[model samples]
Target: MIQLVVSIILYFVIFFGIAFILNMLLRRTWLMAFLYPFVVLIIVDNMSTMEYLKAPGSAFSEAFSRLMQITPVDIAILVAGFAGTIVSGIIIKLLRKSGYQMF
Candidate 1:
């Protein structure tokens, strides 16, 4: 239980920090949120970029198989990370709306 909580917080902070910086630099509120799934795919899949390029079908199939095997706790952690990205986007949007210079 402790490990699960730690994992959730760790993932959330990591994603939030990355997304926050990306939002500040890119000046797009939801860019990181929109790209979070692909980031998760890269993290979860074992295939290299070259492998994915060379054998797209097999790579995607393997990735999907691995995705299917993730436990509920892992899914929760991933969801937390996604939520962090969304929250970062919302914060950035709010900051810009309130006349703060984000860029």
Candidate 2:
């Protein structure tokens, strides 16, 4: 489980690292706080769309036929991604409120 923990930490580090850089680069813009979530959703949508498109015609056409087969995994990923974003947002908000002022 140590490996899992390490990877999770790394994920947050990378995401927050990007946020840190973006906050610095886009300081005082109408972008940083508000645009981030929508940006993430759009990115995720594009990626999933690309994955679907890359599958074979017959396979991709029936991809959702097995939707319930991996419901747990899908739910876990959705929860993790949703929770991660909220947690990260809170982390950034708290850090900024603590006078760090990321944006």
Top TM-score hit: 1
Candidate-wise lDDT, in order: 0.91, 0.51
lDDT of 1 by residue, 2-99 (tens): 99999999999999999999999988888988999888888889778788899999998998898888889989999999999998988888898899
Compared with the true structure, the alpha-carbon lDDT of candidate 1 equals 0.91
Q: Which ten residues in a row have the lowest lDDT in candidate 2?
A: 38-47
**RMSD per model, one decimal:** 0.9, 6.4
**Could you say which candidate leads in lDDT?**
1
lDDT of 2 at 52: 54
How do the predictions measure up, each by TM-score?
0.95, 0.40
lDDT of model 1 at residue 34? 91
Q: Residue by residue across 1-103, what tens digits does model 2's lDDT show?
A: 5755665566556655555566556653223346555444443443455655577564444544444344454444444444544555666667677888653
RMSD of 1: 0.9
